[model samples]
Target: MAESGQDQTKYLKGPDQIIPSDVLKTWEPMGAVKLKMTKSGVDANPPISVPSLLRRAADKFPDVKALCVKRDGAWKSITYREYFAKVCTLAKAFIKLGLERFHGVCILGFNSPEWFISDLAAIFAGGFACGIYTTNSPEACEHCAISSRAQIFVVENQKQLDKVLEIRERLPDLKAIIQYIGKPTSAGVLSWDDVMALGEKEPEEQLDYRLSCIAANQCCTLIFTSGTTGPPKGVMLSHDNMTWTAHANSVNIDFALGKEVVISFLPLSHVAAQMSDMYMCMYSGVSVYFAQPDALKGSLAATMKEVRPTVLLSVPRVWEKIYEKLMEVGKSTKGMKKSVATWAKSIGSEICERRQKQDFGKPVLYPIANKILFKKIKKALGLDRCKIFISAAAPISNEILRYFHSINVPLTEIYGMSESCGPHTVGVETAFKIGSCGRTPPGFYTKLLDKDKDGNGEICMNGRHISMGYLHMEGETHEAIDDEGWLHTGDIGHLDLDNFLFITGRIKELIVTAGGENVAPVIIEETLKGELPCIGNCMLIGDRRKFLSALLTMKTDMDMDTGEPMGTLQPLALDWCKSVGSQAKTTRDILEGPDEKVMRAIQAGIDRTNSKAISNAQRIQKWQILPKDFSIPGGELGPTMKVKRSFVAEKYSDIIERLYDV
Candidate 1:
C-alpha cells in the first residue's frame, strides 16, 4: 500500500514543532461571543491546557494512587507522580520518533493504561489524539488515520496492529506503529517497551520546549461520530474544551478530590468516556481502575466488586442488563425470602421518594429494609461505595430508572453530543428527575430554537465547553454552529419550568407520515418496550407511510465470545414467555410455531401502546418480531448500544414494506 519514493522528512523533524498551517485553516470563527467569554473574567474559569492540568494534579497528589491496572491476577497501582512522569517520558519519546505538531496520534484498542498514556502523550507532544473504536473495520480505521494525517499509530494488541498493518502503506504520513500490549511481528514496528526505552534515552530539553509552546485554544483531540447518518466526521476539541468541561463535571457531581474512584470500561473513542475516564479523573485527581477488555460482556461485575468505585458512568444498556439480572434472581425467591424482598423494595421506594422531595425523614421500616435488602443488593452490585451514577449517550427508560430507585440507586441522566464535549447538561443529586436530562451546568447555556405550540424545539448550546468545529468539513460545521456560537444540536427537547431538559426526539429520526403529520418514533418505541418485557429492542418505522409500525427483537441469549445474538431466548425473556403461558424456548420456537400465547401477548402490548398515542399517526398499527436480538457485532447497535435507526430501517425494508403492503 506504500506510495514509493514519497518524502517523509517533514514528518521526521525534531521537537521544534509549530501548529501546521493546514490544521490552522480548519479553525472556524468560534464567534465573537464565545471569544469574549473565553477571556478571563469574574465568572469564567481561567483557561488551562490539559498538560498543565496533569502537572498540577501530580504536584497536588504526588503519592496518591491515580491509576490501577490488573496484571497477572493482581491489581497494580500507579501514583500521580509516576503517572505524570510516564506521560512526560512518552511525550518525549513521540518527539524522538518524529511526531509532527497538530497531526493525529491515533490509538485503537480497548480501555487500558497504554491507551490512556498514548492519548495524553500525543496531546503533550503537540499533536491531537484520535481514538478509533475497537468495533471499527480496517477501512474505518484508515479513514480516521488519513483524515487526521496521523504520524504515530498505537494499538493495544496484535489484532488492532494487524488492521493497521493491512493499510499502513497507504497512510503516507505515518511515522511509526507502536503495539502496546504485546511484541510486534511486523518489521520496523515498535513495541511498548521500545517506546519507553526511546524515552529513557531522549533528553528532556526539546520536550520541555514543545510543552512551553502549547496553548489552550488549539485543537488537541478529535472525536469521530458513530456514522449512522453518513461517514464519520472528526469533531475537533480544544484543550480548553476538555479541561473546562472536566472541571464543570467535577463540580456538578461534587467529586471528592483524590477520593473519587471510577471504572474505565466504556469505549474511550466516545467523548463521554474520554472526558470522564481520562480528563475528569486528571482534573479531579480521581483514581481510575481499568476493567477487563470483556468488561461489557460479563467481567465488569467482578471489576466493580474488586474496585468498589465511588463514581460510575454507563450507557443505559448496562443498567438495563443489571436490572434484568436482578429481576431474574428475584423471580426465583420463595416463601419468606420473597415476602421480605417485596416488603423491603416497597420501603426502599418510599424512602427514595421522600428523599427526592427534600425530605430526609425515612419510612419507619427503612432501617429494616436497608439492613435486610438494600445493603445486600448494593454490595452484590459493588455499588455500596458509589455516590454518583450517571447515564448518558441515549435515553434510559423510566421503568429502569424507577426500578433502580426502588433499590436505592438513582440513575442521573446527562445529555449532550460530541460537539458539546460530552455534557452540556447533567442531573445532580438535588435537582434530578426521572427521564429528564437535568439542568445545564455552570459555564454552559442552553436555548430552544423554532419552538412548536408545545414549547419543544431544537436544543442549542453555547459555552466554553463547546468544541472547535468539525475538521475539514466547513459546511457541516456551519450548519451545526451558528453565528452566535450556539451549537445547534438536532435533538428536539424543551426545558421545564425548573430548567430540567426533557428530550423528546431527534429531527433526523422524525417519521413524517403520509397524512402530513410529524411523528417522533423514540417515545413510541420506548413505550412499546416498556409494555413488553420479552422484547429486547424496538424500532418504529413508517416515515411517510399511512401509519406507524414497529420492528421488534425478542430478548435472546448472546454468544459472549463473539458478541453475536443467539437464537435461544434470554432467561428473563423465557421467564416472560412462561408468564404468558408460552413454552417457547427460543425466538425461532416462538415465531415458527406461531405461539398463540406469545403472539397474543405481544399484540396486547402493541394495543396498550396504541391506546396512549397522542395521534393516530403515532400509533403502532402493525408490528413483527425479528428472529434475533440487536447487538454490536450484528450491525444493529453502535458501540454504546444506541440503535442505528437509519441502518435498521434500511436492513428491514422488506419486512416494513410487507407490513404496509398488507
Candidate 2:
C-alpha cells in the first residue's frame, strides 16, 4: 500500500517554489503576492506550441497507444505515431483546400478521436479551430461559425450536417463541410477519406514548414462561451494560452507521463475536457480512450472498468450522479450487510476527518476497515487506480463532497472559465479545504473587485493562460479584459487567509429584493436541492420583488439514484407524497398537476431550507413546482448542466410572476 504521506507529496508542491521572482515582484504592488500560485519549481519558460507537443509525444512514445475509440462494437486504437501522421495528413489537406494562416475551421462534434485530430490539424495547418457544441441549435451554430469566420466546418453525423446545411447559404465564408462518421449525402459535403486523400497529394515539406512557422501567440482555437446570459461569444485562445494551460495543469495535477490513462467523456467543445484530456494528454503522453457520446451515461461504469484510469476529471453533475447511485445501493442493503456498510462508512468518514486535520495516527480498526470496505468501494467505482478525481466547470454541493469523502472518494473541486483556459484554482489532496476551490495555479494572478462586507467580490484573473479576447467583439473584449490585463470573471468569490478561493455566486445571477436586501440565490437553491430528493432544479426568483420566491423542477420518470423506473414514487419520495395527500401513481403524475399534497411536500422542503437561511430576507416564501426539469436539450440548461438563468427566467416569466402575485 502507498503511504498517504507519500501519495499526497507526489501532487503537492511547496508555495515558495511556484512563482518566478521577477513575476512575483511585478505583481506584489497589486496585492497579487497574497494569492497562491502553482509552482513549477523552474525558471520562466516559453510553452511548446500544440503542434510541437504532438510531434514531441509521437517522437517520444511512437508505439504507445495515444488514442482509442469504439468502432463496430470494438475498441480500436491509434498509436502516437499514427495519431501524429493523421493530424499531419489533415493539416496538409486543409492547406491544400486553401485554408490560410489565422483562418478558422469550425468543428461541431461530440467527444471523439477524430475531433482531436481535426482540432490539431487546423492548428498545425497554421489556422485556428472553432468548437461548436453538438447541442447547439442551427441558429446558434450559424452564429458561432459567422462570428469566428470559419472557412471549413466539420460535422459529426447526419444530424449536424443537416443543421449546417440549413444555414449553408447564410455562411458564405464556409468553403466545405466534412462529415466524420457517415458517407457524404449531399453536394459540398465531403467524407473524412476525401480530406485524407487531398492531404496525401500535398507535399509533406509544406505541412512541416507551416507547423514550424507557428508562433506561441498565434490563435489556435475559438471556444464559444455557453451564453447563458446573452448570445455566445467566441473566446480566442492562442497557442501560448493552450500550451501554457497544458504545462501548468500537468505540474499542478501531477500528470504521470506514459503511465496515466484517461477516458475522454465530456464534450470536447468545453475547455475543461479539451485542456485536461486532449492538451494534457499530448503534453504528458497520457493514453486517452474516447467514450461513445450517446452511451456516456449508461456505459460509464463499463468504460471505467475497462480503462481503470489513473486520473479522472469530470463536472459536478457526474459526481453527484455517482454519489446518488452509491447511496441507493447502500440504502437497499439489509440486516448484516446494512449494518456492516453503515459501520464501514462511519469508519471511513472518521478517517477522512482525521486525514483532513493531518492526524496520521492509525486507529486499531483502520487497516481492517480499509481491507474490508473502503478498498472494495473504490474498486467498485472503478477509481481504485485513480490518483486524482477532479470536479470542475461548476460548483458541487458540499453535502455531495462530504458523502464521497465518507466512502473514500476524495473529490477535489477546481475553479476557472474559458477566459482562463478552464482552470484557475484546484484543491490538492495534501492541502484541501472542504468548500474552497484551492488556489490560483502557476502563471496566473487573481484579485477581487468591488468587495462586499465579507470581502466577496467579482473574481478577476490575470494570467498567461488567459485568452487573447473575444473574436470580433472589441467592445466586449475591452469590457472583459482590462488594460491592466485582469479578465473580469463576473463570478462572485473571496480569498481566504491561505488564498484558497470560495466561489459564492455570479454577479449577474444575484437576486435583489425591493426590501433592499441582496441575496446570493445559489446558496439557497443548493440548500433546497440538497434537502429534497425529488427536486431536480431550484431557481430563486425575486429580483426587485418584495420577497424571495422560487421555481422548483422535480426529477423525472427514472429514480435519480438507482435508474429504475419509478412507476410510482420511490420509497422516500412516496412517503413525502403520502404526507402531502398526493394520490399520484407515478413521478410524472405528480409533476403533471402536483396536487395539494405534492405542493405541501414541496413547501415542507422550502420550510426546511428556510430554517437554514442566515436571514429572513433570504428565506424562500413561496415556490411553484414546474412541470418539467431544466435540461440541455430544452435550452434551459448549459452543456455542463448549469441553469441558463436568463433563459429560465424569461421563459417562465408568467409562472414566476404568479408565485408572488398575492
Candidate 3:
C-alpha cells in the first residue's frame, strides 16, 4: 500500500496524515460548534483515569445518583463519594498486589458495578484493562488470557472463576482471581474481599502522584478483536483513543446522550456497544439501565419504561429481527394496519432520501401513520424516548434503515472496530447516504490507499483514534501498518461525488468465479442478508469450479407461539432426528441423521437457490447442514465467529468429493 500526504489543514498532522479537502470544508462548522460547547473535564489525566470522569460529574451533581447498582432484586444507589471510596480501595489493593503501570489485566465477567469498578481500578492502578466477552468458549477465554499474559483477573462469579481456573495451568502469568460480585469463590482462592481487606489496613495517601506514571498517550485498554479470520488479536489503544471516540460521536450528531437515560443491553466486550454504553455513559453521567442477561426483550422494555432512555445503540441483526416482526404483524393485518405499515416504510424512505438532497427541516410524515404505526413501533422497541439509533459492527440493509426511519427513528450508521479504539465514522439522517457508511469521523484523517482513477482503494486512516499497536504481534503490526504509520484497513470503498462513503466490499473477502471474474462476498452477503433475514448467512463457494454453492444456517427462534423452546430441548441426537424437514441445510457430507426427509429438503433449498445463480457460479448439488454450530472448540469457526473456510473444506472433503463427482 502506498501512503501519501495531501495536506489542506495545518492543524491535523502525523507521520503521513493529511487533512482531506472535504474535512477542511467542514472544519469551520465543527470549530464553531466545539468552541460554543465546553469540553467536559471528564478526561483529565496524567493517568487518563475513567474514575476521574465519574468524580467530575459527581462534583457537578453531587446529590445526583452516580450509579444505581441492582442486587438482591432491589435497586441500590452508589453515590459519588461511595463510588470513589470503592474505586480507591480497589486501586490501593491492586497496588499492594503487584499491579504496576502498563501491566495487562483482564476483566472476565458480565456487566456489573464490579466490572466497571475493576476496569476503573485497573486503569487507576496504571495497567491496561482487557474485557473478555463472557459467552466466549473456554478455549476463546484461554486464548485471550494467554495472549495478554494478564497477571490479575476480576471475575463476577464462581462459573467465571472456574473457567479461569480451568485454564489457569495454561496461563502461568495469571497470579490472582478477584471476585467483584457473587459469593466468595472456593476456600482455595483469594477473593475480592481479601484484597479489600489489605486496603482497609492501610491509610490513604498521595492519590494523584501515585498515578503519574500513566500518560494520555500511554496504552490504556487492549481489546481483542473478534477474529473472523484467525486467532483473536489484541488492539492496543491509548487514552487519547478512547477520549477522541467520545468527542467524535458528540461532534458528528446531535445525540445529547449525556443528559438523558441510556440502556446497556449489549455485551460490554464489543467496542461499538462498549464505547457508547460504557465510556460514553460514564463520561456523560447518563443513567444506565442494564437489563437481565436472559431477559433481553422483556428486560429491555422494562428498563426502557423505567428509565425512559433517550439514547440507543444496537446491531443490524437486532434491527432485522424487529423489522421482520413489524412486517409480520403488518402482513397479518387487514386493510388499515397493512397500509399503515407500508406507508410508514415508504414515507420513511422518502424522508431519508430528501435529507440527502440537502434539505434540513422537520421530516414530512403522514401524521396518522406516524402516530399509529411508526410511533407504536418505536414504543414497542423501547425507543420512543431515543433521539437517535446508532447501528454498527456489521452493515445494515438500506431497507431496514428505511423501516426504522419511517417510525421517526433516525438510524445513524457508524463504521469502526476495536482497532480504531471505537467508531471513527458515523452518519446522521441529515448527512447520511442510504447505502454508504458516512463521512470521516472527527479527530481522524481518512484517505483511500492504492486508488486508481476512480479513487477506489483500501481505506486507511491515522488519528488519536488509531490503536497503539497489536499486542505481542510486531510482525503482524508491520504487515498491517506501513512505514508512514497509517493503518491499512482491509476494507474497499470510494468517496462519492458528494463526499459520502459507499463501501463496496472487503479486500480480503473477495472470491474468484469460474469465469475468471473477481466477486466480493461482502456485497453479496449484505444483499442476501438484506433479502432473507431467516437465512442467517450465505457463503458463495465457487473458486475454480463450474459454478458456486453455499452453506446456509437458519435464524433460530428459541421461543415459539406456544411460549416454549422452538426445537427439542431434548438430546441433540433426538432433535436432529425430529428436525428432518427443518432448517438443516449445510454441506452434504457433514450430515448426521437418517437421510429420509432432511436430505430431500436440503436438496430442494439448494436447487431453488441455484436457479437464481448464473451458470458458472451456481449450486449444482449440496449436503445436509452441519449438526454443530461454529466455534473454536467445534473446529468450525474462529474466535470472532468467522467461518474457518479451509478447515470446513478439509473436514468435509469426503462429502464435497461425492457432491462434485456426481
Candidate 4:
C-alpha cells in the first residue's frame, strides 16, 4: 500500500493494476443495454465522450487541415484547432439557445463542415444529434423531427428551411431553425453567422459543465432507418458505440494518422457515411473534403478527380453505373487501343483470381499491362491513389466486383446495419473473399441463429459497438435486441469455413409461395439481371401466391439533373437491342408496341434464369417490363439504392394482381 500523498504508480505491477474504481461506476446504462466491459475490451475502446475525442485530435494536430470546403473555385481549409474552436463555440450557442439535455439538434443537409460542426456541438452540449436526409419529403422531415423531439433544426439552404416551416405547426418541440447556406428569408430564422455571434456573448462554463456530465454509455446520436418495410425507427447510439467502432475501424483499415484523405458526399443521415465521413475521420485524424451537392448526379467523377481520396466507400449502384459508362466508352475503341485494353483486363482478372485464392503472386505480364493500360484507366477515373475501395449499404453483384478487379481496382464489401454502428464485418484487402462480407473486427462477436439445412441463418451480433436501443420504442427495441443482448439482424447469411460472412437474403424479403416453398428473391433477381444485359432493375414477387413472377425495367438514360429515368435507352441497352436484331430505340417503343425479336430475347434470358432455379415454384412463371427504371425520385428505391419491397408491392398492386390472375 502507498502513503496518502505518495505517487501510486510506483506500487503498480503494470498499467492494468492501476485501475480506477470510479471508472466503471461512472458508466450510465440506457434502457436494457448493460455495459459489458472486459480488460481487453476496455483497453481497445477506452470509454470516452465524443467531445473528448475531438479535443484529443485538436490538441495533437492543431495545425493540420481537418476540413476543406470549396468556395469561389478555391478550396478553403480549416485546421483541427479551428474545427474544435468552432464546435465549442457552436455548442455554447446551442446552450444559449435553450437546447435541453437529451433533446436533438436535427441537421438536414448535404455533407459539409457546418453539418459536421453542428452534429458534434449538439453532443458536446449534452444533446443528441439527429440527421435528416436532404431528399426527404416535408412529411418525412416532420416525422424525423417529431421522433427525435428536435429542439433545433439546421438546414442547408432556403429549400430545406421551407420544408420545416411548412410543417412547423406540427413540430411543437422545435425551438429554433438555423440555415447554413444563404441569408434566412423567414422571420425568427438564424443565419450561420448569427449562431456564431451568439456564442461569443455566452461564457464557456455552462458548456464545460454539460460536457463533463456526458457519459460514454449515454445516447449521443440517433440514426433513423430508411423505412423500407414500415415507419422509420430511431436507432439510439451511445458515445461508446460511435467512439469504439471508429477506433476499431481505424485499426482494421490501417488508417494512417494525419495522412488519409476522403471525400464526403454520401447522405450524412446514413450510418455508413456518418461513420466514415465524420466519426472515423475524427478518430484517426484524417482530413475530409466536401463534394458538390450534385455528387451523386454525375458530378461525383469530377469531384473524385479533384480529391483523389485514399479510400472510397460507395454503394453498389454507383459502381455499376461506373462499370456501364466505362464499357460504353470501350465499345467505341478500335485497333491497338482495344487490343491492349483487352490484354490488360485479362492480366488484371488473372491477378484478382489468384489474389482471391490467397496466391498473391503476380503474373509475368502484369507489369507491362499495368504500365500501358491499368495506370491510364485509374488516372482517368481519378482513383490513382485510391488504395481501398469499399462497397456497403447494399449487396454488390459479383459481376460488378470482377469488372472493377479487371481494371486493377478491387472492391471490398462491408456488412452492417445502423444498429451495428455501420460496420460489423468488414472485408480486408489481404484476407477477403470476393462474394463474402469479410470478418468481424476486434472486440466484436457474431453468431448464426436458427440455421437451415444448408447452414444459412439469421445473423446476430453483440459488441461494445452495438446500439443502446430504439428511441422511445420499448416493444420494437425488445424485438430487435433479445434478452441475451444480441442484435437479431433480420438479414440471413452463412459464415464460410474461413469465417467470411455471405449474406443470402433478408427474412422479411423471403417469398413463401402458397404451396409452402420458400424462395430468396435476391439471388433470383441477380440471376435475371445477369442473364439480361438490357434489364436495369428486377423485382420478384410471389408471396402467398401460387407461382412466382418478376417486374423488370429496361436500362435507360437517367436525367443527371433530376435523378429521374428517361425514356431513351442507354448506349449499352441500344447495343443489346441491336444485338438481338431489334430496331427499337426506347423502352416505350419496345413496350407499347412489342417487338418480336426483343420479346424473344427477353424470353430466352428468363428461360436461362429458370433453368438454374431449384424448384418450379422458385422459377419466375411470368415477368413484365416497366415503362421506366427504378430511381430515388420515382420512390422505387431508398437513398442508399435499396429497393423498397413493401412500397413497390403497394404501388404496383394491380400489376402484381394481373400476373397471378392468369
Candidate 5:
C-alpha cells in the first residue's frame, strides 16, 4: 500500500478494454437470434415507445445530466432539467405553427440536442418528424419534402438551408425552414428565434397544452432511407416503436447506467447512433458529448480524456481507418519495432481466432506487446476507458474486429434500418459471432422468410419498433409491410442453428448473369473489401453479361502521387477515383495508368474468396477501378454513409452499359 500522502492516478496509456467474452462466449448460435436467458425470459414484444421515454426521463431525472456540446474547443453541459424545458418549448412552438395530429414536420441536420428536441416537439404536437440527411442532394431533399408534405423544415446551418432553398419552390407543402445554429440568412427561411417567438408567451401554460395533445400510438416520426431505386419515402415510425428497442437492449443487457458519459460522433440522422447516443444515455442519466464535425479526432481524443466515456458509437469506416493506421504503424517502425510487429500480427491473429470463436482474452504471451503497442493505440483514439463499441450503418470487416480484439476493444454489431429508430438485432451482454449481426432484441419477431434450405431469404421482422408505414406511398407501404405485420427487409440472410443472423446479400441487388445464375454482389464485394485495404468498396457488374465484372473504389489512405499504400499493402489498378470529379477529362486519364498489381490483388481476393461461389459468377472478368472513395460529401454515399446503390448504378450507366453490352 502507498503512504497516506502518496498520489494515486489512473492513466489512459493505451487502447480501450471491452469485454466481449460474455456476449459471444457461448459457442452456440441461434441462426438469427440467440439472446441469453435472463432471470425471467425477456418480454418478446414491448410496446412502450420513445416519446413516453422522453416524457418519463424528463420527469424522473430532470435534474440529472443530459447533454454536453463542444463549442470553442471545449464542452458545455445541459442538464436533464434544461433538456425537458427545451423539449417542451420546441414542442409548443410546433403546435403554435399550425402542426396538428398526424401532420408532418421534418428536420434536416447533423447530430445535436436540437434534433432530439425537435423530434419530441413534433411528437408532442401530435405530428410526425421526418429527418432528411443534411448532406442529401437537392433532388433527394425535394423528393422527400414533397412526398412527406412536410409542413416545417428544421435545418442546422447555412449549407443545409442552401440545399432546401435551391428547390424550395417545388415543395408546395413546405411551410418554414427553422435554422438552429445561427440566424436564418437564406431568403424565405425563418430563424429558430422567429419560430420560438410564435410560441405562446405564457411558457408554463404552453407546455401543458402541448403535453395534453399527445398519445401513445401517434406517428412519432418518418425516417427516410437514402433510397436505392426510387424517390425517398418516409418510413413512419410510431413513438412506441421508437422506444421499445431502447428499453429492451437496455434491460436485457443490464446496461451500464447512472450519470455515466456517452460520446456521440456519428451523424444522428441514422438510427444506431441515436440508440446509444440519445436514448441509452438519457435513460442512464449519462452526460452525452457531441463532437463537432470538422474536429472529430482532436475533439474525440480531448473529449475522451475529459469525459472518459463509457461508450463510443460509429460506423465500420472508422474501425477500418483504425485498422489501417495500426497496420501502418506496424509497417513504419524499424528493428525491434519490425520484430514486435511481426510478433504482434501473429499474436493478434491468434487473438482474433479465439475472439471469433467467442473464447478470447485467453492467457496470452504478449504482455509486453500490450504494454508497449496496444496501449499506445488506445490513447491516441481516446478510448482508454471505453466500455463498449457499437458498430452499425454498414457491414464491418472481421479483420477490423480481430484488430480491435487484439488491442482489447470489442465491437457490438447491431442491425436495423432508419425505419426502426435503431437496433432490432443488437449484441447485448452476450459475446459476438464473426459474421452474424447478433440476436433480435426483445419484442421483435425475426425470421428469414421465403428462404431455402440454407435459410437464405428476406430477413423480416414484426416488432414494437416497426414503423407505421411508408408515408404517402400506399404502393410502397403495401410492398414493404405484409398483412401479417412483418416487414420484408429486402435483405437476404440465413440463420444458424443458434439464431445468429448472417446476411448473405441484398435481394434487390441480386444479379442474374447471361448464364441465368443469380448472384449477390454484396457477398463478393464484402469478401474483397474485407481483404483489400486499398479498396474502399466495390460493386459487381455484368449482372446479365458473359462474365462477372466490377468497379472498385480505392481507399483515401493511399497517396495518389505515389501508388504505394503510404503505409500497408498497396493494391493494383487504382486512380480512377482520384480523377472522377475533375473538371477535365485530361485529369480523368489517370485511371488509364492504374497499378496492374493493385488490380490483380483486388481480383485475386475476389476470386479466392469466391471459391465457394459457382465458377460462372466467381471472378470479375473485367474491372474498372476508381481513385476516390464514395462519400456523403461527394454526393455518393448518404448522410449515414450507406451506398445509394441505385443512384450509383444509374450515374455510371454509360460505363455499366459498355460492360454488359460486350
Candidate 6:
C-alpha cells in the first residue's frame, strides 16, 4: 500500500476521526516510475476528456476509417468525421430528452457500434454513462440501475428491453427507455430513429456547451465490478482517469495512428474493453471493427481474416481454445507434414528460449524456421498482421502463453481491475516474461502490503488511472481506497527485482486446512489443468477441512470448426476419452456417470499433482466430476468467464460434503 505525495489532511474529516491502526500499516508510500516513452514527449499533450479525444481524431484524421461493422453480410465503414457526427447527434438527442448534466444513463446490451455511440453521446452531453452486462439477470440489471440512480436506460433489442421492463417498477428515478433496434413494445419507449429525429430539431450549440462545461475530475462512466464475492459495485471513473489511461497505453504500446486495426468483441460493460477497444482507439486514431455476439463462435476467423487487425484483445479461455486446436491439428497430421511440424515447433521453442534469455542475435536457422513454419501458422490463425496480442481479465495458463510465443505470436498478459480504469501493468513483447504479468506502466505505482514469508502480499496501486470510488458506498469506498488515495487491490502477488508482477492468487480465495496450513488453490488448479489437458475447469475446496479436494469439468461440448459448443461432446474429446479407456459416448455420461476407467484417469491426474505438492495437506485427498462446466448463464461464472468461487461452492455444497464424508 503506497501513498501519493498529495496532502492527506484534507481527507481526514470530522473531529473524532481516529484512523484504524491496520489502515495506517497498509499505507506504505512507494516511489513512482515513468514509462520510457513519456520522457520522449509521448503523452505530453494528452486529451482532457473523452469527447475531446473523439473531436481531436475527427479534426486530425477525418478521412481515416474510425469504425467498421457487419451489416447485410458486408462490412460497412464509418470515417472519423462520420463517427463524430453520429456521436454529436446522439448527444443532442439525449439533451432533447431532458438529460441534465451529470445525470446517469445506462446502456444494457452487447458490444456494437450503437453501444459505443450511445456511450460517447452520454459523455458529450455531460451525462455519466454506465453499462449493464448482457448476461445479467433482470434483478442484476435492476441493481445497477438503482445503484447508479439512472435517469434513462438504453436497450439493444426486445430481449434486453424485456429485462429492464420487468424491473422498471423498481427503478423510480428512470424517466425514459430507448431501444436501439426493432419497434418499442411498450408506450413511452422511444426508437433509435425517433431519438435521432429529436436531436435534429435541437440546437447543436446546446450539445457543444455541455461538452465544454465538462470538467476532467467529473465522473464520466460507472463500471460495475464482476460481483464474484457479493453484489456488484459501481466503480466511478472520472474523465481524467480514463483519458490518462488511453494516453498512457497508446504511448507505451507505440500505437500507429490510422494504421492499427482492432476488433471490438469483449463486453463493453468491462473496463478492459473500454480502455483498449474504445478509448485507446479514439485517442490513437485506430480503426475498430465490431463483432456480433455470435461472431466469436461463428465467424471470428472469417472476420479476423478480413480485418487482419494489428491488435487483438481476448480472455484466457479463447487463447486456451486456440492452443488446444493447434495441438489437435498436430495430433491429426501425418508423414512429411507431421515431421515438418515437429521440426518447426522445435525451432520455435529454441527461438523463444533465446528471446527469453535476451539473446536477440538471431540463429541462422531462425529465419528458415519462420518462413517454413511460423508464418503459415500465424496466417491460418488470422494473426499474421498482429503485432500485439493481449490476454487479460483472468489469469491465463503459462503453457498457453509459451505455445503462442513459440509460434511467433507475441502474446502478453496484463493485470488490472475495474477500479484502475483497465490495465495498470502490461507485458510488452520486447520485455515479456512468461509467468509474470509485466511491470507497472507509467502514471501508476504499486506496492505489496503485509508480505508473508514468501514475499507475497496484497497488490496495492495508486495512480491517475484510479477510479473516484464506488458510487454511494462510502464505507466500502474507504475500505478500498485509503485516505492517501492508494487503492487496495485484493489480489495477492509479488514483484521481482525488475518490477515484473507475478499474481499468485486472490487473498479471499486462499484455502486454509483444518491444521492451519495456508495454500493457494489456483496454483494447484492451474497445474492440474496443464498436466491433464482434458480438464477444462478445476475448483479446489478445503477451507476448514482436513485436506484439499476438487471439482473438475471437462472441455467436451465444442464445435471443431468454430470452437463453439455443439451441445454435445466433440469427436476429438470423445476420442481422447476413449483413448484413456472410457466407454462414455456422450458428455453427460463422461461427467455424470463416468466409467471406472474415466475415474482412474482422473485419479492419475490427481496423483501426478500430489507428487508436486509441498505437503500432504496441500494435496487433494478426494475429488468429484461436475456434471457440467461453469458458465455465465448458469450463474457459476461471471461475464468475464471467471468462476464465481463462492457461488459454485454453495451450489455444490452437498457434493463437497460428500468428499469429506468419505
| The candidate that achieves the highest lDDT relative to the unseen native structure | 4
Expressed as tens digits, the lDDT of each residue in 1-662 for candidate 4 is 22223333333221112222211111121222345567765334467668878888898878888999998899998999999999999999999998987788999998899999999999988788999888899998888888888889999999899899999989999899999999998999999999999998899888877766666666789999998777888898878788878988888888888888999988899999999999889888888999999888888999889989998999988888889989998999999999989989999899888887889899999899999988898899889998989999988888888888888897889999999999999997777888899998778889999999999999999888888778878688878887667899998999999889999989999999999988999988998898997999999999989999999999999898899999999988999999999989998889876888999999999999999998899888898988889999999999999998888888889998988785
TM-score of 2: 0.90
Cα shift from native, residue 45, model 1 (Å)? 1.3
Residue 334, candidate 5: C-alpha displacement in angstroms:
2.8
Looking at model 6, report the run of 10 residues with the lowest lDDT sum. 27-36
Give the higher-lDDT candidate: 4 or 5.
Answer: 4
Each prediction's whole-model lDDT (CA): 0.85, 0.78, 0.62, 0.86, 0.65, 0.80
Q: Model 1 over residues 511-575: C-alpha lDDT tens digits?
A: 89999899988888889899998899999888888888889999987887888899999898998
Per-model TM-score, in order, reads 0.94, 0.90, 0.80, 0.95, 0.83, 0.91
| Model 6 ranges off by over 4 Å | 1-47, 558-567, 591-593
Superpose all Cα atoms of candidate 6 onto the true structure and report the RMSD in Å to 1 decimal: 6.1
Better of 4 and 6 by TM-score: 4
Worst 10 residues of 2 by lDDT: 24-33
lDDT of 5 at 117: 78
> How many clashes in candidate 3?
5
- Candidate 4 error regions (>4 Å): 1-33, 41-44
Clashes of 5: 36
RMSD for each of the candidates = 4.6, 8.3, 8.4, 5.1, 12.1, 6.1
| Candidate 3 local lDDT, 1-662, one digit each (tens) | 11113222343222112222211001111110001112443222122335455566566545555566556787777755566677778888877777765576788776676776677777777676888887676788888877766778888788788888788788777767788765674755667778878877756653343455444444567788776577888877655567556655655665553366666667677776668766776556566666655433334556666666687777665566567666666655788767667776677666666787876554455675577676777777677777867777777778778767766677878787777766767777678877777788545667898886768888887665666567777677777766555778898889988878877767776667667765655565555555443444456565665555555544434342222223222232233434554444332322445455655654555555455654434334444343433333445553234456767767766655655574
TM-score, cand. 1? 0.94
lDDT of 5: 0.65
Candidate 5, residue 409: Cα displacement in angstroms equals 1.5
Comparing 2 and 5 on lDDT, the stronger one: 2
| Candidate 5 per-residue C-alpha lDDT over 1-662 given as tens digits, one digit per residue, 9 for 90 to 100 | 22112231221111111111222111111001112223444443434445557767777778777887777766677778788777767777776666655566778887777787787677666566777776677888887777666778898898888888898778777666789888776677777777766663536564554444343344556667766666666766554555656776677556665646777777665666767777776666677877665433324555566777767777776676666656666555789777776676566566656765666475567676667766777777777777677778778777677667667666767788876667777764245676678887556679877888766888998765666566656577778877666778888888787677887888778888888877888778877776555567788876667788787775544343332232222222223322223221221333556544444555677667667665656667776665465665445666555677776777777777777663
